[model samples]
Target: TKMDKHNLTVLNEFILMGITDRPELQAPLFGLFLIVYMISVVGNMGIIILTKMDSKLQTPMYFFLRHLAITDLGYSTVVGPKMLVNFVVDENTISYYFCATQLAFFTVFITSELFILSAMSYDRSVAMCNPLLYTVIMSQRTCWMLVAIPYLYRTIVSLLITIKIFNLCFCGYSVIRHFYCDGLPLVSLLCSNTHEIELIILILAAFDFILSLLIVLVSYLLILAAILRMNSAEGRHKAFSTCGSHLTVVVVFYGTLSFMYLQPKSSHSFDTDKMASIFYTLVIPVLNPLIYSLRNKDVKYALHRTLGALCNIFSQSSVYHVFH
Candidate 1:
């Protein structure tokens, strides 16, 4: 046990080779990522704020949406800034503890997103299939529990995976071939056999993925059946409108993640994997707010109201200053 601890202590720092090494690409890449990150933060934050200020949005759907926005904000924030800094800087060195921390938080947030999306799907299903009982079934207490379960499950799973990975000796190489600390890159550096750890990660990831996927699948299937049963065309259209944005986000998010993690590890390509990572880590966060706001009329109305109120406040402040 003492000897194992000593091995892990020897590897204190790891150098990260980011998405690109070309000096010419660095400036453009930095600017692009910076802009994307800013937009993502503002947009997701706006969603959360709109939900809070508008009573019309005080429903289970919006409740789940607010958390989804928060999760996207956090997920991107965890990785984007680090990637931007690494893009501009020379040495992208991260301490073992720091790497572990990044992996831990990233794990929690990413897995949380999956579970939250699943919960949102269930919410949509209830609204469609059992419209009369939707509010009672998805009460405030139930909504809180839906939000809580994912974070609790992922945090515990991440802790176990992190502990297991850190125990193995990283003797050969100290360089990770990615912008941030990810499991596969870190595992590649291990001097010991990683079959056990890989198997553990695979199982955990599968459980998270499959469990959430089943929920989404089942929810949408029920939702589709309900829509088919509706006699009026307008009734079916109204039902689909409520879930269109969520379904779009679900497709994009799950599509990328399934491509990334669900396949055999032997199929992985570092460069290709990094590109896929960018979509989820950078592109998706920016897309989420745009997707939700653009598709949902209620969110657009809320945003307009929020912006109009801010303008009025500013106009009042200006008048007061002039009089003073």
Candidate 2:
């Protein structure tokens, strides 16, 4: 038994029970998650590259979008690959140190994504409500600051949470039912009293959720009001078109997250929690790039332009090779 400074025994590693132990389910689960992971990485990477290459997309909206894509890519990569490995491998064990690291990074990116969404909502509000002032208000420096603030804040908070939680002594139970080292799952495994930790988490989570929701809600309300004031039908359609994709993403992301975290701890069900985690972890990341690219004409145009240029370059290379 490993003794801590408090003389409490701690575990060195944990066996993840994952979604299911059934042999029949393993193969199908692996295949499904593999497809989702691939799409997430490719789609998010495409968005980042497209945004960078297309000067037209250098606005505040796409600035947040680029960071959001990066965060989604990071978040999905942090969680998906480990889970994928677990599905294929016979032993689904994770070192204590690695689990803590996963939780920290997961917290950072997930929180960053939430804040990025809030920033996007604010950008939409400004664009719709004060079109003439949008450029002045969302200057390049301002946009970079907005993106940087979330990463800074979330990183600090995640570190505190990680340190505090890991300090708690884990009892004899080393099996975490969930695939990843989630906050609640880790809390549940602790042998010591978790009242203080639970309270801290609840307060932090509520504040984060409430703040982001308010920003999104208030921004959209003003956006709606602005849309109603528009004289031209085309103008109103354009405003709605720009905001629709973001609103859809916010709903899906917050819906899954709220369902996962907002409930009473006593009512926590591992099976249901795992399902909710899958939506945000696997489904939302894949859907985000699709929603933005498919709905926004700018992104579609940028993608087409980039691909066309690449094809032209390839064709020229082929012709040169033939001549040589």
- Candidate 1 matches the true fold with a TM-score of 0.95
| Stretches of model 1 off by over 4 angstroms after superposition | 1-9
lDDT score, candidate 1, position 143:
99
Model 2: residues with Cα > 4 Å off, grouped in runs? 1-9
Q: For residues 34-121, could you state the per-residue lDDT of candidate 1 as single tens digits?
A: 9999999999999999998998999999999999999999889989988898987899888889899899888888889999999999
Q: How accurate is candidate 1 locally (lDDT)?
A: 0.90
Cα lDDT tens digits for candidate 2, 187-284: 88787889998888888888888998999999999999999999999999988989999999999999999898877879988888999998898899
Clash number by candidate, in order: 0, 0
lDDT of each: 0.90, 0.91
